[model samples]
Target: MGYGLPIYHSHCRIDENNQMFEEGREIIYVNASIQEDTALGRLMHDMFCTDSRDMHYEFLRKRVSYYKENEGGKQEMCEIWEEIKNKGKLEGLREGETIGKQAGLAEGKILGRQQGVIEERINSIKKLMRKNGYTLEEALDFLDIPKEERSTYIGIFTS
Candidate 1:
C-alpha cells in the first residue's frame, strides 16, 4: 500500500499485560535510529564535543570531570561563576540606581509644587491677619487649616 503522508516510527515494547480484548491483536516491537548526519545529531555532537577550547562550551565533559576531581579546577570554576554572578549583580545595581534617581526627581518635583501651594496659602493667611487685625490662631482657623499642621505653616512663614 502506498501512503500519501510521511510515516513516523519509534522503538517500543509491549508489557506482559498488553492485551486488547476486543481485537485480540499481538503487539509487535520496532526500533528506529537517527543518522549522525542529521541536523539534531550534528547539534548534539557540536555541543558535547571537548576537542576545542571554545568558551561557548563551558560545561565540557573534561572540564566538568576535572573540576569535580581536582581542587584547582574547582576553584577556577568557582571564580568564573563568581565573576559571572558579580557582572549580573553590577548590571542590576546600575539599573536600580537609574530607576531610583528618576523616582527621586519625580518626588522632588511633587514636593516643590506642594511647597509652592503652601507658600501661597501662608501669604494669603498673613494678608488676612494683617489687613483684618486677626491673631495668628484666628487667621489659621479662618483659613480652615488643621491645628496639627498649623505649626508647620507658622514655622515656614515666620522664618
Candidate 2:
C-alpha cells in the first residue's frame, strides 16, 4: 500500500473504519514492520484530511506558535516549525483526501449497521406476528409502518 496519498476511490477501497485498501494490490508477505509502518503512515496521512491545505497549515502553525509561546521561544523551534510547514505543504492534500475517504467509509458502515439491525428487528417482528397467527396485512397495520417502507416490509413478510 502506498502511504502519503489521497487514496483515490477509483483505485482504492476503504472499509467502515476508514481503513484504506489499494485495489489489485496484493500483500504476499506478512511483515510486522511493514504493518507498523503502514499504521504510522496512516496516522500521519489522516492529519491532512479536510481538502483544505490552508486550514491545516494555519492550524499547525497556530499549534506551533502556542508551544513556542509557552516555552518562551527557541531557535530550534523555528527550524522545526519550518520543516513541519514544508512537509505539510508537500503532503497535506493527500492527507486531507485520505481523511475524507475515511470519514465517508465510516459513515457508510454506520448506516449499513443500522440498516442491518432494523432489518433484523423487522424480520423478527414479522416472525413473531406470524407465530401469533397474524396475516401480513394485519401485522403491517399493527406496526404502523411508514408508507414508504410499508411496501418493502409487506413484500418481505408475504414472501
Candidate 3:
C-alpha cells in the first residue's frame, strides 16, 4: 500500500511477465509513492479520500457527492445495501444450504438495516414537520436535504 499524490490503484501479480502459469513466480509491485504521475496513483489517492470534496477525480467525487449531499443519493445507497445483501446472501448460501433457500434470509437482513435508517430519517422529517409546523420542503431543507433530491421523497413525505 502506498500513500500520497492525488490517487492511485494497486495492481498485483505473481511476476513481471503475462504468464498465468505457476512457475518462476516473481512478485511484481509498483510503488504508488513513486508513480504519482500515473493514473493508478491518482486512483489510489481517490480511494483514500474521506470526503468527496477531497477526492482528486471529478468522476469519483461527483458520484460520492451525489450520495452524500443528495437525499435521493442516501436512498440510492440503501438500495445498494439491499443489492449487497442479496450478494452476501448468495455468498453465505454458497457455503450452506441451496442458494434459493437462504437467499431471502441474508438479503432481507441487510435490506432491513438500510431501510431502518431510511425510515428513521423519514420519521425525523415527519416529526419536525408536525412539531415545528413546517412544510415538507421546509422540513427537508431544515434537515439539510439537497434540493435536487427533494422531489424523490415527495410522495412518501405526504403519506
Candidate 4:
C-alpha cells in the first residue's frame, strides 16, 4: 500500500486484470499515461525519451526557462552555475600552467645548447691563440669574430 511501489506482471498483457506484487504484497498501479499532457508526464517524457545530447540540452534549457519564468529555485540554479564556472576556470588554469612549463623547458634547453656551442668556440679560439702562438688580433681574424664581439670573447678566455 506504500507509494512508489513498482508494478510487476506475469505476462506482457497489460489490462485491468493485471496484478503485480512486491515481496508477496499486492501493489496498486495507477495509470499516469492517461494524463500524458500533465507537467509530471512531460517531465518524465523528457527525461526518458530524449536520447541525443542536443535534445537533452534543449530539454534542460526549457526546464531552466520555466524555472526562471516562475521565479522558482533561482538560488539553487545560481549556486550550481557558479560551481560549474569555477571548476572550468580551475581546469583551464591547470592546463595553461602545464603548457607554459613545457614551453619554458624547451626554450631553456635551446638556450643551454646555444651557450654550450658559444663556450666551445671561445675555447677553440683561446687554444689557437695560446698553442699556435697567434696574437689576439690574429685569433679574432682567424675565427671570423667581429671587432664588436672581441671584448666578450677576450674576457671569457682571460678569466
Candidate 5:
C-alpha cells in the first residue's frame, strides 16, 4: 500500500506447474520460519531487518550499509519506491508473471542513483580542474575521493 510496506515474494511448484502445457509435475508444499538457519531462510530474515547489524549475513549487511551510509538512508529508499510505483502505474496493471517489472524498476533505480552521484562528483572535479588549473588527479585528490577510487574517475575522464 505504501513505501513503508515490507515487500515479499513467492515461487511455488504449483505456480510453475500451472504454466506447463503437458502434464508431469510434482507440487510439493513445505515451509519454514525465517529463524530456520538455511541460506534462503537467513536471507529472508535479512530482507525484513531494519538495521544492517541485525542482518543474518555479512554480505547482506554490507549491502544494507551501502543504503544507510552511501545511498543517503531512508529517504533515498522511499524515493526509489515512489518512482517504481509511479512508473508501474503508467505501465498499467501487472496481474501475473508480473514480478519482473518491479524487480527491473528497483534495479534501474539503484543504478540511476549511483550514476547520478558519480556524475555529480565528476562535474565538481571538472569545475575544480578548470577553475584552479589543476590536473584530474589533483582535482580528485582535492575532492578527497581517495587514491584507490581515483583510477576509475581518471579512466572516465580519459575516455
Candidate 6:
C-alpha cells in the first residue's frame, strides 16, 4: 500500500510454513506511531513486523526525560515495555529459526531460475540444429552443452 509514516498494511497470504514462491505476495507493515530510528522499533519492524504501539514503549525506554514531564506516562511506558520485551524476545528467537528457512528457499528459487534459463537456451539450440539438418546429438555438441551435464540438458529438452 502507501509507504508513508503510518505503515499499517502488513498482510500476506501463503502456505503455513513461510515458503515464498514466485506468485506469492507478502506485505509487511511498520506501525505509524513508532519512530523508525529507535533500536527496538527497527528490530520489530524489520524482523517481526510489529505495529506502532508495540514499539512505542520500547522507544520510551531510551528516553527517560519524557517520564518526568508526564509521570503516569512514564509508568505506563515502563509497564508496556516490560510486557513487550518478553514478546520481542520470543519473536526474536522465532525469527532466527525462520531466517535459515527463508534463506534456503531463496537459494532454491535462484537455482531453479538459473536452470530454467539454461533449459531455454538448450531448446533454442535444438531448434536451430533441427532447421540445419543436424541430429539431436550433433546439435547438442554444436551448442557445447558440457559433457558432464549432457544428461540433464537432454532430459530438460526431451521433457
Best of the candidates, TM-score: 3
Model 1: number of clashes? 0
Q: Which portions of model 4 show Cα errors greater than 4 Å? A: 1-105
User: How does model 3 score by TM-score?
Assistant: 0.39
Model 6 C-alpha lDDT per residue in residues 54-92, reported as the tens digit of each score: 434455433444553468767667646644654464456
For all candidates, the clash counts are 0, 3, 12, 0, 0, 0
The TM-score that candidate 1 achieves is 0.33
Inter-residue clash pairs, candidate 4: none
Instruction: Evaluate all candidate structures by whole-model CA lDDT and list the values in order.
Output: 0.58, 0.53, 0.65, 0.57, 0.63, 0.57
Cα lDDT of candidate 2 equals 0.53
Query: Candidate 5's residue-wise lDDT over 86-106, tens digit each?
Result: 445334423212354456666
A best-first ranking of the candidates according to their TM-score comes to: 3, 5, 1, 4, 6, 2
Best by lDDT: 3
TM-score-superior candidate, 4 or 6:
4
Q: Model 2: per-residue lDDT, tens digit, 1-159?
A: 434342322434466767767567654322222323365444444354443333324665565555555464454565356546544543554455456557876655555555565556466665666478677667667767667877766544343
Clashes of 2: 3
Ranking by lDDT: 3, 5, 1, 4, 6, 2
Candidate closer to the true structure by lDDT (higher is better), 3 or 4: 3
Q: Tell me how candidate 1 scores on lDDT.
A: 0.58
lDDT at residue 149 of model 1 (Cα atoms): 87
Candidate 3 on 1-159: residue-level lDDT in tens? 534334343444547786456454455455544436467777767777788888788999999899878998997786567556544644563445344336756755555565555556667776786589788888888888777766655645442
Preferred candidate (lDDT higher): 2 or 6: 6
Evaluate candidate 1 by giving its C-alpha RMSD to the native, one decimal. Answer: 25.5
RMSD in Å for model 3: 12.7
TM-score for candidate 4, please give it: 0.31
For residues 48-152, could you state the per-residue lDDT of candidate 4 as single tens digits? 543333223475757655555445567456545754654564456456655755787565555555555655665677578658978777888998877888886
Candidate 3's displacement at residue 55, Å, is 1.6
